[model samples]
Target: MPDPFDPSPDSGDRFTFGLWTVGNPGADPFGPRTRPRIPPTEIVAGLAKAGAWGVNLHDNDLVPFDASPTERDLLVKEFQQALADHGLVVPMATTNLFSHPVFRDGAFTASDAAVRAFAVRKAMKGIELGVELGASTVVFWGGREGVETDAARDCRDGLGWYRECLDFLCGWVKDQGWDLKFALEAKPNEPRGDIYLATTGHMLHFIETLEHPEMCGVNPEVAHENMPGLSMVHAVGQAMEAGKLFHIDLNAQRIGRYDQDLRFGSEDLKGAFFLVRMLEGTCGHPAYDGPRHFDAHAYRTEDVDGVWDFAAGCMRSYKILVARAAAFDADPEVQEILEHNHADPDGIGPILAGFNASNLAALEELVLDPDSLATRGHRYERLDQLAMEHLMGARS
Candidate 1:
């Protein structure tokens, strides 16, 4: 059986994992601040042990967004020391745009200039800290960049405010010479009725309009995508192809519920497998410049360990996906389908007809024959055996 952990040429280069600890140690995602079960250091250590490349830290996790300079400074120093002690690098950090009540109207898109300025100032401080901590990217998920009542508000003006805010924020980052990227994560509607950049395509269009190479990019979240009835695989593919897929936020959701950041692979295994394929098979090999930001909502009550377990499960699922994709690609029938589809789009009708009537039966046997040497342990082994059999006659 093939080793699922082995890295292939197409495997992802920078294996980034995020720690969404904004409300950790005490605070739950919804409410009720519990006692600290595990310290932050242990979480970092566990991530490193689990083969993660880096960690994503949120602004609140490091310090209160509205803290005094002296307080902020102390917290910054503490965060830096924590990272150094654990040998964990922060690839990204997000502003505390969602925690405070002042952002009810919106953060960057607030109609009130005062609120907008405060939000920007908060984000700038977070960016500076992220730079200090050697983070590669600063994420901006417009938690409040939406409209609850569009009837009273001028939609165009609101959108204009958002673009202006992004331009200003992104420009500041570029001027800092921080070698950092700005990732904008989009969610359809949660805190607000209608999010400004609610989809990957919408993000792409916005980024193109920004025209700042270092300014903006999309961080597509799995559950976020699924919530809007979008296919995760297609979304990832589109982002990759557009050269705008700057970061990734992985999590699962209940098919049609609110953004539930469940553990990876918890929902839609086949879809999750395909997402893995898109990440490894396509996005991994390229000189893809970005981060894999985990925007997870801590679903379990165990706190830190639960988050670590979720991250580990994500990695394991990634392994399964890569293995299966490799095997699928190796199959002659699959290859034939791909080639025919690519070479002659109209030829698919005739090409598929060439397969014998018993082919489905044979394929089923190949997939389910437990005693078969190929049907052993890992999913990779089974897939590889099936592919090999398809490529080299079944009798062989």
Candidate 2:
């Protein structure tokens, strides 16, 4: 439904995108990167002109690993200047621990003591960078913090190591007096057969075990959750309800497949629409007010222009879905359906309250009363049709 040929309109502060989203060569393990590497400063300029108020990145994405102290300082200074010139800000920053060879075993869960310590240091450094960049959230995506086989390591030790890592990070933040929060990201399986914090539920529970639970939250990515065919809206709602939805990544993926990181609304429009509604909806009172970063990639077949189009499309599609959701709310028929039959049965409250036998009788009567039951009319097919019409822009 996207018009790739349309002019790229400014999204204002409605969205933010990751620095890594641009110029992806679409490489795999066996293939090499084909897209030209654009400098991080240039990338910031492009995103600013594209109308993003903020950008997210991994530390190494903007700052090279092999740079000397002076070189790193120069790089950071240039990046800071670029931000000032373009009026852009940093929403989040993360450590790229998995890409380095030292983390072949894992980052936080590495069995080797030196490797584990180095991973911790790298993460601390990444947090410092985020603080310097005025970022609100620091993300930890443990892509390499898992084992290919159970026999390769002990699960207890791995969990303990992960706990130690998070506790240290939390303590480090307090020591530095930074105002940033940590957003822990999760994926079921990827570089490893099973990731340590494998889902939003698991991540939330683990966050409670941290030294500063108040400073820890989850950064749920749509594609990561959808990889296992999870209801993206349900996963996001869980994080939002807990008031721990620190950040979000918007992307698309095929069911039960690799982390494709497909363009937004490329695979699932209904799912995408519902997600936008839940995030931007007033009825539910969305708990998150952070940037919607498009952590997706361009297809291998596309060129540089296609990459820009992909970026524009990400913002445009999300804005369109948000508008459609607003329209859905304004529609009188939709509101009528919601008021009449979208919620739990009205008789349920009385049935669940008092334990008296008379109350039980009343509950039974409510169920047996054909007239009351018949009044609960759910026009699901029509409701779905209404949403579809909006999605297609065919209200007529």
Candidate 3:
């Protein structure tokens, strides 16, 4: 329910999309074998050419956590220069907390204090890079924050370790005097049986307890929500209503399965469409300051280009949804229907029955139309015009 007459903000019109590239571009999915790699600079250029507003580079991309100082410094310089050359901004970056063998037990959640300390150091480095690159946010995905076995786990100590790490990181960022928001991306279970913050609800609880309103927020990935048998649109709507949706990550959800990171609209098209509409109808016109975060696993062999294509399509889809929602808003007859529905829910059947076949046909026509803007224009303006004409003649 946005104001129909309000001018769309520049930020809303400029839809930003991000690319998530962490691991080997051509690494085997089922095995640990690596293949020939593409340069990260080429990836950045490709994304910029494909109409992305920014990129989400991982800490590992800057320098593998275990690399020598010389190697790390060189890699960081190369990435920073490439981003500048391509006019790509880094809105967010993540720590490499999962890939190292030292994190087999966990990184921040490890029972060993030394391991936990090492993880914190790595995260601090990543945060520093984010600040240096002028990123708006930094993400911490608890990749190893889970237990494979219930019998041998020290739940209390593990939880304590995680909180400590988060508090320390937040405090460090606050001390820096940066306006960077720290986002916690939640997943039900992957790489572990139960992640520390497994759902939006869990994340909310943690944020409330932490009480660091300026430092923390949730980044709900669409696929992750579906993995836990929750509706993505519903979950996002709940977050929006509660004023907790600071950012979002778009990917297709495989019904009743783990995170797939498939192309947008690949599996649950209805859900995807609704999500686009919700984002537009709510966040689009107002101009959200946060980034459109992405957590895409490289599913296609084309590597970087494929990732960009998917991200671009997602942004385009959202734009189309926004335009359509605006059309619906401009239609007086449609507004009347909505208003009447609000006033008298039980009276809807009789009113709906009046148009019956024609109404059903018009809906199908509008939804199935190929031309995006034209379809919306016809459905909203034309349908309302026809309805108004009929109503006036009947009254006469």
Candidate 4:
């Protein structure tokens, strides 16, 4: 048998990593930098060697925040050359809105008008860089766009300011005629007490109110959703259903903890399995065709080699789970249970489809066995157990 975990270049997994993710210097809140930073060119080469299809970045990840124009041009040129030499693409890009001290309070939602203006300008530059590098998606993670205390500012004002910024950026993209879309990322709370639009569901609704709603979407992260104990699978499903799943961040985290950013499939095997099933369309929905970006970091204890190991592990784990989900869905018992559960003997599909006059009359005339329906078990226990068995390699 062939090696299932092979990170072969021809593999269909369009896995990607951010320059910041692999180049993280093992620094955290308590400790100083443990490893030296790797250059963007070297990071690209590493990712390509490990079988990654593309790389992602924050503007500052490649060019320093205060670099002169000449310096910025040099850095970008070098990085682009590295990408060409290594056969990699830049799929997504974002701005570092949370790292600088000027964004201490917030970026787009900052109380200071000047601060908000500066944030928008910085985002414009980030968008230009993304377009220059041929990225089709730009993600916005409002890491500090919230408050520790509700007394800071009215959330209504914050939301208005947020909407203004996104609307302005959407208009700017339209003027430039770049084939780019904005993806808003959500986080419950970490750097701040509470972040506005704190979940994928919130982002979805917010996008609808945008000036160019069609060009906006949500980039839901596994760790961000899992931090709040939300189901990542459902969150992605909602985005997919709404035709807004433009990108995704695949990482693992322990529920109710700080953003762990663990390797994919490390902590929650079952969740990851079903997530793969959904993304691969093993659950009967169309598969999502977007960059499977891993916005995660290696353990604080890992060195340079371990960082590469972590990157490779993420891609391999995703591929392994893909195979497992396919096998689980193909199992005879699993299909039978699903078919039986979905059996609509009363022909209610069209009646529930809409409230037409004839459909309503048919619905009113339909009879349901209330007592028997309430007692009919879904056999989900057995189905869930089988899922676990497949995930655990206990079943073929």
lDDT values for all models: 0.69, 0.83, 0.68, 0.93
Tens-digit lDDT string for candidate 4 (1-396): 867686765767699999989999988999898888988999999999899999999999999999999999999999999999999999899999999999999999999999999999999999999999999999999999999999999999999999999999999999988889899999999899999999999999999999999999999999999998999999999999999998999999999999998999898888899899999998788999998899999988889999999999999999999889999999999999999999988688979898889998998898888998799999999999999999989997
Every model's TM-score: 0.78, 0.91, 0.76, 0.98
Question: Candidate 1: worst 10 consecutive residues by lDDT?
Answer: 6-15
After best superposition, candidate 3 residue 21: deviation in angstroms? 3.8
Q: Across residues 1-396, which tens digit of lDDT does each residue of candidate 2 receive?
A: 845323232423446777788746667787877677778898888887766678788988888888787888899899999999988889799989899999988989999979999999999888888889988799999999999888978978998999898898888888888887999998999988888878888899999987889999999988888998888888889889898899998998888989999888888889998898988863457535888788998887777778877887887788778778888877888788777774665556757776998887877776467788788658888889998997888762
lDDT for model 3, please.
0.68
TM-score of 1: 0.78
Mind giving the per-residue lDDT tens digits that candidate 1 earns over 3-65? 556322234535566555322444545776554544445666766676666777767765656
Number of the predicted model whose TM-score against the real structure is largest: 4
Top lDDT hit = 4
TM-score quality measure for candidate 4: 0.98
* Winner on lDDT (1 vs 4): 4
The model with the greater TM-score, 3 or 4, is 4
